[model samples]
Target: MKIGELVKQYGVSVDTIRFYEKQQLLSPSARSDAGYRLYSNADSQRLGFILRAKSVGFSLQQIRELLLIEDNKAAWQCADVKDKVQLKMQDIRQQIAELEQFYQALAKLDQACCGGALSATECSILTALEQGKPAQPETHQEDASC
Candidate 1:
């Protein structure tokens, strides 16, 4: 298939496909006499893999390594794949924890503000930000809450 056909079929932008080509993630099987890039079913499958890996937060380098393993599946070990997955899971967990902390801090600030014609100087969120501290909850319950 042609590059244009690949773009339409995958619902991905032409530039993104081009970028993947430049990154050495996807390569055309052949070029037509008219200079158009030509792809095979194998190339299409590789493109799908690249898109799916990226959607799940794999870096381009990681995707490239995965492609290498996929291309040489005869010598590939499942343990290597498991290691990569574990690292990704750890990073995701860390991100979630940080986001939860930010959410808690924001909630505390929101709860502190009454929002009745308060000036910027009196805004709890603004004051907390200027003080470089998260606003404390007005009432601390005995049980842990976020």
Candidate 2:
């Protein structure tokens, strides 16, 4: 099939498909006499695999590694694939923990402000910031007075 057909079937932009080609993730099986890219059924299945891997947060490099493993399934063990998934899960967990810390810090700052028509000079949040005080998660006070 042609590139346009593949784009319509996948619901992805032309640039996205072209970028995948540039990234060496997906390649057309052939080129038409008119210089248009033509894909085979195998290429369509490969594209699907790439898209699904991306949706699951796999980086392009990681997807490349996965594709290599997939292409040579006889040379790779199931344990190898499981190890990659476990590593990705660990990375995601660490990111979530860091984001939670950021959220807690922002929440503490938000709760410190009364949201009244007070002047900026009397803002406790600003005072805390000016003092270079680090957000202590254990010291979340409920007082909303500025």
* C-alpha RMSD values across all candidates: 5.5, 3.6
**Candidate no. 2 TM-score:** 0.84
lDDT of 2 at 106: 84
Model 1 steric clash pairs: none
Candidate topping lDDT: 2
lDDT of 2 by residue, 1-146 (tens): 99888889889888999999999999999999999999999999999899999999999999999999999999999999999999999999999999999898889887767756657786767877999775333332334336
- Lowest-sum lDDT 10-residue window in model 2: 135-144
Off by over 4 Å in 2: 118-123, 126-131, 135-145
Against the reference, the lDDT scores of all candidates come to 0.85, 0.87
